[model samples]
Target: MNLIDTVRIALRALLKNKMRAALTILGVVIGIAAVTTIVSIGQGASRLVQGEFQTLGTNMILVLPGNTKRGGVRQGGAPTLTSVDADLIGQQCPEVLASSAVVWTQGQVIYGNENWNPKEMLGVGPDFLTVRNWQLEAGGFFCSSDIESNAKVCVIGHTLIPKLFQTTNPIGQLIRINNVPFRVIGILEKKGANMVGDDQDNVVLMPHTTVRKRINGSPLDNVHAIMVSARSTGKMNVATKQINSLMLERHEISPGDEPDFTVQDTTEIAEALGMITGTLTLMLSAIAGISLLVGGVGIMNIMLVSVTERTREIGIRMAIGARGKDILRQFLIESVVLSCIGGVIGLVLGTGASVGATVLINMYKPGTQWPIVVSIPAAIVAIAFAAAVGVFFGYYPARRASRLDPIDALRYE
Candidate 1:
């Protein structure tokens, strides 16, 4: 038969037994859906991780407190970063553009009758916003004079403002932190949650001096950590090394002895996190791929049954000058049609599922936008795999149909 004629015959055959055809294609639908959904989730995760890191900026170094040990060995002491170290680094390191020593205290914040107990309460220098690249959405960060003079001013995060103040213009309003009052100066532009689920939005920033004098009751000498930013990407390594060496010298650490503080590059940390997330994506995709193979097997089983049921029909067609290749083509096309139909259905379902999953994930994590990305290559591969299953599974059935004797088929039924 001609290709078009063969397709028409195949469609009639499948239409004649609608439930059986649907059952045969069920495997393909499931396999395609699983594969497509997995790829979408993987791509979404990779994009989310990359975007999250991008917001933190590039070529930035964070000097954090405490030391890491190995094998039950005492490795180091807590980081005792002070304003003096921050000033020294800013003066000595040419690669460093801005440096800030950060201190913090958590307290109950009250605006009128509303109150909040946010976890992330920070005391930062005037240069903190500059070094960390934080932008103001509503007002401004405190000035150098504010930190030096211990001004009772604060900048609230997007999440903090609504929870405590309730749609009020937070600027110029006084809020009490642990019963100590501070005027609202600015509202920070919203930054979404990081991988650790820490509330990047629910924070309150105050001057380092105010934290020391009013909140902490400690001398204005020590800090929790130092944040530093390089002028360009090229200067990152040099800046880190310079800061490390400077700390070692200041702390009087000798060669082969570990330093007290840890200087971490945000870019490297981001790359490492990306690698981990990427690996997880691949693993999930692989697991989903197994379903496709199962679907292929189902196609084979159904094709064999079809050959058995239509044995007499096959004999008559062969008797009427039909070649074995023509018979083969007819059966193969039937399987392929089933697969293609299933693939289309699966594509719709997979896309919808991925979008729904992304929406739900975003709802739980505000400002973290994860988009459901359709993988074109994955779709193409799925279609190709369906065609391949048709060829592989339809072959034996087609051959069995073609090999039947014409006289015997006429006599049997």
Candidate 2:
């Protein structure tokens, strides 16, 4: 028989037992769906992490305090790094283009009887936005004069606009941070969430001196951390080493002793996280691959059963001058069709699941935007794997059907 006629006959046979055929394809469908969903989630997570790090700009360096070992253990309470340290780093380190010292705290912000707590209330310099590559969505950044004069002026993040300002112009409007009044000078563009799950947009920025002296009862000298941007990517390491050496000298730390502060490149931290995420993606894919293998086993079991059940039909075809190879081809086609159809159904289900998952995650994580990404190559590979499974599993059964003796098959009840 021609290939088309053979396929038609094979399909008609499967149609006779629709329930059996469906049950047989169920495993394949489930396996493929799981793979596609996992791959999509992995890709989405990678993109989210990369975007978050990229926002901090290139050739960035971060310095934090209180890592000094006192009695063989680091002091743990609060950062000991101060604003003077940041200033000195900028002056001494030629590779550093700009530097910003930040003192972080949190307090309820109130406007017109409405109150909401920002995710972050940070004390920073005019260079803070420059180091972080952040831009004002409206108005302008608080100027250097604001920091120098200890002005009661602040910039608010995009998330705060809807909550506190709400359709009104926020610039020049007074908002109370812990009941301490400050004028909003600018609105920051949306930054979304970072890899640590912190909401970057839900923040308020003020001059470090103002926040230290006014909002919190702290000495004007203390700062929690410092952010520095290098002039070139190649100079990041150079800047970090110089900053480390300068900090050591400024702090009077001995060689081979733990320094009171730490200097690190932001890109290095990002690269580390990228490696971790890549490993996680690979692990997830491997788990999904296992499911695909289990589905192949199901195909083999069903094909074996089918060959036995159709023995009589096989016998009649053989008696009517059909060759062994023809019998084998017919059974193999049936298996492939069933598996391919199941794979298609799985692709639809997996894509839908990925979208739904992204939506669900975004709902729980306000200010976070996770994209739904389905890889076309991955989809093609999945489908191809499903078809290959069908062939591998159906071969033994198809060969059995082809080899049956016509007389014995006919004589059997």
| Highest lDDT scorer | 2
Clashing pairs in 2: none
Report the Cα RMSD per candidate.
4.0, 4.0
Q: Can you give the lDDT of residue 49 in candidate 2?
A: 74
Cα TM-score per model: 0.81, 0.79
lDDT for model 1, please: 0.82
**Candidate 2: where is the Cα deviation over 4 Å?**
1-9, 52-60, 69-74, 77-80, 87-97, 105-119, 158-168, 173-183, 192-202, 213-220, 229-254, 264-294, 312-323, 364-368, 405-413
Clashes of each: 0, 0
The lDDT for every candidate, in the order shown, is 0.82, 0.86
* Tens digits of per-residue lDDT for model 1, 275-393: 88778877886787677677777877888888888878887887888888888888888888888888878777888888888889878875566767888887888778777876776
Q: Considering every candidate listed, which one attains the maximal TM-score?
A: 1
In candidate 1, stretches whose alpha carbon ends up further than 4 angstroms from where it belongs are: 51-60, 68-77, 87-98, 110-115, 159-168, 176-181, 192-198, 230-252, 267-274, 359-371, 399-413
